[model samples]
Target: MSFYHNRLLEQDYYPVVRFYYYKEWEGFNMPNHSHEAIEIMYCLSGSCLIEVDGTTHKLKKGQFIFIDGDVPHRLFVEPGKSCRMSNIEFHFEELETVFPSFRHLVSEHEALRMLTESPKSYLLFHDSSDVFQCLNALILELDRKEDESVFTEQLLLGQLFIRMAELAAKQQNDTSEQHVYIQKSIEYMHQNYDRDIRVKDVADAVHLHPGYLHRIFKKAMGTSVNGYLINHRITKAKELLKRTNITITEIPHYIGMNSQQYFSTIFRQQTGSTPKQYRRESRYTDSRTVRSEHFKQQAK
Candidate 1:
């Protein structure tokens, strides 16, 4: 007789849900505070305001906000108005596991990556999918505290993340004319950042007059096209410095800045670090991370 043997790996990575609750609030105001876990607050009925990083956003029924970790925010419901909300705060913990971390998932999904890495501290979107259902199911599963509930909770959480990503993608794909123009302009800027492009050029690319484009772009993006382009270039420079061995002098020209001095000034103004200093710090941090991981594996 012939026999085959197979090995099963133990699952060691799972999400740590700090708190999950569904509550009704009447005329309540929460002080601004921050936490280490990311939070999702969904409005089920009525409306409320969430002030994030000094910007106030209204979350109406069927709407939700994804607040990043360590972002200062507060909730408010006007005096005579009652709001019903479902909230969950959670973070991922990694041990020796076959499953991936949240960062790995973020890197794999473009919409998820954009939502998590956005410059804004919080993202608001209208839920049109099973997001609320999945969230409610997750809360229910977690409350069971049964052995099987662990696996069910993880599955529901994954579904919730996928649903949220779908909503975020839909929000970005807004079909309004102004939103289309702004998206097209932003895409054009990203595609042509290596070239010496201007606001007029972007306007022409989108078939809008410069003046009209300026008004709509600023209205939608909260920044002028020129300002956005500069910020984009700086962001690209930081990526190169952190991830690549490209020389500092070549980075400016590669990012469409003709003068290294000008690039340095802008970089310092934005990041408070020169190119060399930034690169050194990034490399040091990377090396330390590698060493830390190596030691962790050795311990395992």
Candidate 2:
């Protein structure tokens, strides 16, 4: 017998924005997950719960949360209690015609930058009376479904996001700026996981010596440079092992892992399952789940 636990609503679609609006209910909990589209939820008039990547936040009325595509998130509602929120899902596009800032944001690594820095996820109405009122109106428009043109709603939502971005940018005081070099190095390793991504190359890109860079990166990110690189490669390798039909033997070298044994070793270190076990247990991945996520973008 197969048991599917609580999971995110699964669907397939391309890079475009969509809108959802409603009141929430109690005992409403969402399972943890990552997706290709960044998600936004606006809380109207009710109290509920929001969980993102294991962190919990108490959601009150007139608040919104922005979740990055890579983040694993969940939701919860109290039983018999009426709770509601508007959900908007959208993909980040780089096409100028599709999205004006898509190209620059993509090239500049803006998305990741925001995830690590921005605190605009939760828009509290009390904090800004005017913005909160506007958000409420937007939520109302979203709920009516009277608009014949779907794109019209999405454009309005995009405007809301633009305003949020402007405020968050001004308020951002990146104490983490000291770790910028380390973040840059980490992004590089992630991008070249399929090839020989030497620490020297990353260090060179960040303008530091390999030895110095390794120490700084480990201290800042809490994982050794080599270990972190291996971790990402193995994680990716595992995702492919279960999600795709690619043979295990062929998966390693493609992910910068030299041997199946070594790949299996790190796989065990990070994930309790061996590569073989991972593949077997991957029944949960199924075609339905695979269809929702695209190949994660690499840092350029």
TM-score of every candidate relative to the true structure = 0.54, 0.40
Q: Write the per-residue lDDT of candidate 2 for residues 1-300, one digit (tens) a residue.
A: 000101111221113555444555667766777676667666666777778766788777766777766667777877876567667667633232343343233234443336334333333222244445545666676667674554545455545654555545443433255378788887888788898767777788888888987776776778888888887887788779867888888888889877778777778888897777788778666654555554333322
Q: Number of clashes in model 2? A: 17
Off by over 4 Å in 1: 1-14, 95-100, 114-119, 175-178, 181-300
| Candidate 2 lDDT score at position 70 | 63
RMSD (Å) per prediction: 17.0, 19.1
Candidate models: Cα lDDT each: 0.82, 0.62
